[model samples]
Target: MEIQLKLYGSSKILSEKETLDIQLPNNSDIKKLRDILTKIISEKYSRSDLENLPKTAAFFSEKDEVIDDSYKLSNKEYISIIPPIGGG
Candidate 1:
């Protein structure tokens, strides 16, 4: 199943890309998605960098409403992960 992913904030810096089209096994869960993303980010940034990223990660449905990360996503679903904004 193919899914749309959008990364923001420091996560974007780590990914070196704002968005991506990832294909995961059918019925993949949030945990699986997290693992996949972690690996992708780790490839660019150190594991410590990813781990230090704010915990403001979130998942939204097609309607743009906030949904639990564990919420099931369907094929072609669009997921946007907006990390917390930091300032001086």
Candidate 2:
């Protein structure tokens, strides 16, 4: 299955791309997707950055609905990785 990922904030900086197209095996869950993303980011940046990824970012489905690592993804689903927002 193919999935589309939208990167935001720090994630965009780590990945060096606004969007990424990744191919996964059938029945891949969010955890698996996250691992793959981590690998990609780690290769481009530092391993420490990958460690902070899950803590600093939020995941969303194609509909912009927040999802957890256990969420199961369907074919062609779009995932968005957004970094934490701060405002005073």
User: Candidate 1: where is the Cα deviation over 4 Å?
Assistant: 14-17, 52-56, 86-88
User: Mind sharing the TM-score for model 2?
Assistant: 0.77
Model 1 TM-score, all chains together: 0.71
Predicted candidate 2 versus true structure: per-residue lDDT over 1-88, tens digit per residue:
9998897776666545678788888999888887777777767666575677866677888788889878988888888987787768
Superposed by TM-score, candidate 1 places the C-alpha of residue 70 at a distance from the truth, in angstroms, of 2.7
RMSD of candidate 1 to true structure, Å: 2.8
Error of 1 at 33 (Å): 1.1
Which candidate ranks first by lDDT, i.e. highest? 2
Alpha-carbon TM-score of each model against the true structure: 0.71, 0.77
Which pairs clash inside model 1? none
Residue 35 lDDT (model 2): 78
**lDDT (C-alpha) at residue 1 in model 1:** 95
